[model samples]
Target chain A: MTTTLGRPGTRPSAARLGLYRAAIELKTFFRERDAVVFTFALPAVILALLGAIFDGVYPGSDVTSAEYLAPSMIAAGIASTTFVNLGTGIATDRDDGTLRRLRGAPMPPSAYVIGKILMALVVTVGETLLLLGIAVVAFDVRLPTDPARWFTFGWVFLLGTTACALAGIAASSLAGSARSAGAVMHLPYLVLAFVSGVFFTPVGALPGPLITLGSLFPLKWMAQGFRSVFLPDSILPQEVVPSWEHGRIALVLAAWCIGGMLLCLTTFRWHGRRGR
Target chain B: MTDTPAVRVRGLRKTYGDTLAVDGVDLDVAAGEVVALLGPNGAGKTSTIEILEGHRDRDAGEVRVLGHDPARAGLDWRTGIGIVTQDGADLTELTVREAVRHFARYYPEPRDPDDAIELVGLTGKADARVRTLSGGQRRRLDVAIGVVGRPRLLFLDEPTTGFDPQARRQFWALIRRLAADEGCTILLSTHYLEEAEALADRVAVIVDGRIVAAGTPATLGGRATARTLVRWADGRQETDDPAALVASLTRRYGGVVPGLTISRPSLEDVYLDLIGDPS
Candidate 1:
């Protein structure tokens, strides 16, 4: 009866609990290799492919099409990691009984959720690195040098990731099964990526109504933040247009985060049907 | 209220839309005692256990576990309790040790994960991923996680429902040790009457949301000293005292009567009768 499965002597501290849950969440995410490929890896590959294909498409445009596409991929990466990755992960966890097991434990609900967000953050970082690496080495895309702009990039990335992740958690509650979650992610992701300028220019280039519609989502604002960092300052002719108003972006992101969390808190079903 | 039973329940009721899942019920289990709740499928055994576990809210009743109403008890109260549910929905990404250690972090005073695994006889599988373990091994791991916190009261809802015979016996032995050595109060719900007979100090037969009979396995449904059926090669007769009948038969036949046997209703028989399912 002597087993090596002994627990640590003390209950893990809140900090330690967060770390452990994060580590486990990462492992669970990686364990589903197919999901990993579809959610994070596929986006990076698509970005690279499109960059290579459109290397010289719109010559003498204020920026090369590839340079324009690179910044947009940052927004795409955020959307992939936060909403799609999170929704599917939560749905699968619910379907698989992992959430119920966690519920039975004495862990705080906030800690459980924090762990999930942390995992999503890890994936977000990886996606950002992939897109940034491609932009730097393959496309000769210049790194933003202004300290102010770099600071703006950091804030935008964090807020964008949080907002998307929260929205994903909310969507997870609506999904009936893990497979459906994955399937449903496809349409929203493709349409939003295209319309939000993750694969093209912003609202001005698209139809007027489409511009208004695309600006409503977090993806458009996220791309604008990246453009503010990478785009030439002179192109933004109008002074103080609030094109990348960090405060407003933060507020909107916060609203989405709170709204998504409330929806998930209200509707997510951990205990699956008994027959299942 | 201070002298309340470890578990005191009265008029417990629950409904799922139109269906009355758990009708009015009453029962109690004292401190440091193990009680088994027994019934067939759809007999409201699980619904009642869920209500007691505080996982599901009740429609109406006074229910308490360890002096506090489970429905209203906060985290402080949940810490003192353990539960081993029927389903094992682990993500299977961590080693056995890692999973147990991770959950141990939640409790205020958890037992050593190693000790918990050892208690359930899964020491060898500690380093193995949960996905690699056999069904019985995974079940033991579930039990390990349930007890890692050294809970004062444990709720095991069909803990052995899917276990094979040998594994079921092993789990029962583990439960006995938990009760005797750790002095943990246990409420086990099972469809298997044999399991109740083996592990419970007292068994409560629940049917249609109410407890139909509650007593020691020997006296359930008047099982103790009930008519003993004596059977011989030529005939069979019911008697109050089988020993006296045997003695008289031995004298008449000068000892070693032909195929003479005494039989009493088994726990299953009595349980079936109590639950209104004699088949």
Candidate 2:
């Protein structure tokens, strides 16, 4: 047998490998019906339910309850798709030996991370569209006509999803097993949604400390940024600060993205907690 | 560099807190050779293999795989090694072909995914989802993924642990085909004495993190040179010269020794003795 020694420049480029990883990631993700329903449909269901329960428009604004909720739920949907989905999904991978198998292969770790984020991006987009459709058709919420609002929607979606996805990757390492990951990821997400005024109308109505606490995380700023895009400026006085803090929202989400990346780098484990 | 052993280790040691898992150990596997690490549970077989695979860090060791220290080896080195771990990846949603093809992309030069599936006798199951495969078929899929990269060295960590008798034999045949066709160096770990004897060119018996004996199946623990038992209908005797004892017994019977038998120790006996297991 001939030995082939030191074959240089033979590995597929990292970007190409990442795309392959993403392809597999998406394929497997969509096949799991439970995951699709839980990750993609749960937020939309919550929005529909909330839209039905809350009937009145805000005290001084023409924006109905459903219209106010439609945008914030989109933000929550992003968190669900990226943060909760990735946290549990990565934990499941670690638990089920997928990460171990990948680690054993010649594929770069960065490719695996990129694949997961890309899968989240695809799922988040689908989820956002579903929620928007439900909001507009079922609850009579209006789509944004202005190009500037759409532009705000794009950057907020991108930054918010990136930040939450990174946080999910970082948090995946905290779960001891796949069974516990749902709890570990959802507890913080639900709490943040409440304190961020995702379930409530008018962010100013939330307790001062709760709002302050929510501001420290990405979800609150993400919800606020989305509200700026969908809700009319007349509704701006209902905000805690009475103005759209677009710059602060971008800074916070961007910072979380960087911070979350660092956390993932420091904490990511390719194996289960007791694997070694 | 071509002459360097596919795997070489000296003074390999690892510990978990205060408990030493792998103590001072030395092993070598030449290219194209098949070596089995035979040990019972908790005997450091996994620790040593994982260390060699670069999946686990060693507390102290000088180890080289494919002519490079696994600890510092890059992707090039990784591409030359394939690992079939005990627990296969959960690719339940993917068809066997898809899983094999997915892994094939990781390597620069990979076997055709269909051919790899054929090599592992999984062509019929190629289109089936991984979750639908039987235990034996799932393990075969793991082998397909491992070999798709065309690795120069393959590490199989107890590949047939839970296989039935027929499945075990089939898996052994698959492994033998790989050794013959691919000429790849294989380092397998297993606790089954029969499995080690069947698949290994050389068997190394590990006990409590140390190699107690290492040799071919017939000669392990000096079994080849050990006293043989010569038995007849009336009596039995253990002697160094079994042939001479049998001749004497035949002559005493004046033609043939009734119910006569001559045998050396079986590999199981030698292994049991080597591991200090009375049972």
Candidate 3:
């Protein structure tokens, strides 16, 4: 029997509860050694490698390939960790009964959703910063000085991160177990990175069909946004536009973000397959 | 309202594909009562409990838990109910104390995390990660999480399935405390007849989604009034009163009857009979 008398219980506001859960999730994210390396270290390593092979200026462009690939890789890393990682993690929780427990608790379902989004965003932002640091040091890529470009990059980052995160959440329903979740989420992530021109870009010289196909994805828009910031004005002729395609990129990424969120809200499976 | 029971069910029904999981069963548990739902596997115990816990949608019939229809109840209503599911969910990389503390935040009136852990006799391993705990220990953790909310109504689905005898006894004691001290109403399902007799104020036997018998353990299926058997070295008699039969047998032997035994049917016997033969 409990010997110490407890104080009268107090109910935490829903928002407070959500932030608390998010805090714990963030802590767990860092503590899980594999996840930390996968989300944070793996991208930096890949970026460094990409920076090595393609760091020099492109034949038709003034900017080194690192300046171009930096943002694309950043987008790819965010997509992999936030979208794919969250997908598998959610699936594992479902398979293992965490979702069931949460469902039964007094906490709101939104609290769980909020916890995951916050976790994804926190890591996405952190990983982006780390990738930026590497781009600066290893590849000598410089941060954009123009306030206008920074503003554009900010919204592009937000839209792209959330779009991928929502897509991952939506895709989790397709997975029956954690093992299957990896393959289910990985396919689209890899496909998007490749088709979006995140890799092998200087897209002007690429096949017109490929560039058109890549333009449809948010990853491509995110990459273009970064290029606009890092590449000089002289590189405009080979770009998607003379400077930044801020309006078009924002429009596409935002549309994807809204569509993905709606899909997740409608189709997301909160419980495990066992219930069926 | 004080008159309302902790749980009330009327014509509860559920189905999985073509099979009925819970039939038109009616049950009621008064406030502060410990009611054990006893049945074999696939007997609809889990399905019924899940519906009552509001985790599953019932196909038909009316059900109320903690005075609200669980099917439509909101978080305010859920604040008073606790469930320790059949399978414990493993929270990766969190210590016992941390997990308990984390779940405690989800309730309106939660017990102190440390106190809840101690109540489950897990103080020794408070800091141990949940994955490292033994099966029994993790089960204890599950119970701790369930009770930390200080729920007015607690649902335990085969709570002691993996427990050793000592742990089972300890669990029974903890549940007794929850009932006796906090007036928490408990609805649990169990396979062990002893667990039913030791903890439940009443036992309800279910078979094939129907309650075949329900009463206090001694009186379940009229077990208390059932005939007793008196046996001696070479003779046996089924009678209402075994003491009189034993006395006559002693007199026939002009002393203590050799190999004398007065026995009545065990709860398990009546249970098997009610549910049909187990073998």
What DockQ does each prediction reach against the true complex?
A: 0.33, 0.55, 0.42
For A233-255, candidate 2 gives per-residue lDDT tens digits of 88987889988999999999999
lDDT (C-alpha, whole model) for all candidates:
0.80, 0.91, 0.83
Instruction: Give the winner by TM-score.
Output: 2
- Output the better candidate (1/2) by DockQ: 2
lDDT of 1 by residue, B122-211 (tens): 998899988898777887888888898887788898888888899888889999999999898899999898999999999998887778
Q: Roughly what TM-score does model 3 have, to 2 decimal places?
A: 0.94
Steric clash pairs (candidate 1): A3-B123, A5-B113, A5-B114, A6-B113, A6-B114, A7-B112, A7-B113, A7-B114
* Candidate 3 residue lDDT tens string, B39-109: 98899999999989998889888887877888898787777788899886558689999999999988766
Candidate 2 colliding pairs: none
State candidate 2's DockQ: 0.55
Q: How close is candidate 1 to the true structure, as a TM-score?
A: 0.89
Predicted structure 1: lDDT:
0.80
Residue B256 error, candidate 2, Å: 1.7
Task: Rank the candidate models, highest DockQ first.
Answer: 2, 3, 1
Q: What CAPRI grade goes to candidate 2?
A: medium
Q: Residue A246 of candidate 3: its Cα lDDT?
A: 79
User: Can you write out model 2's per-residue Cα lDDT over B167-229, one digit (the tens) per residue?
Assistant: 999999999999998897899999999999999999999999999999888789999999998
Q: Per-prediction TM-score, please? A: 0.89, 0.97, 0.94
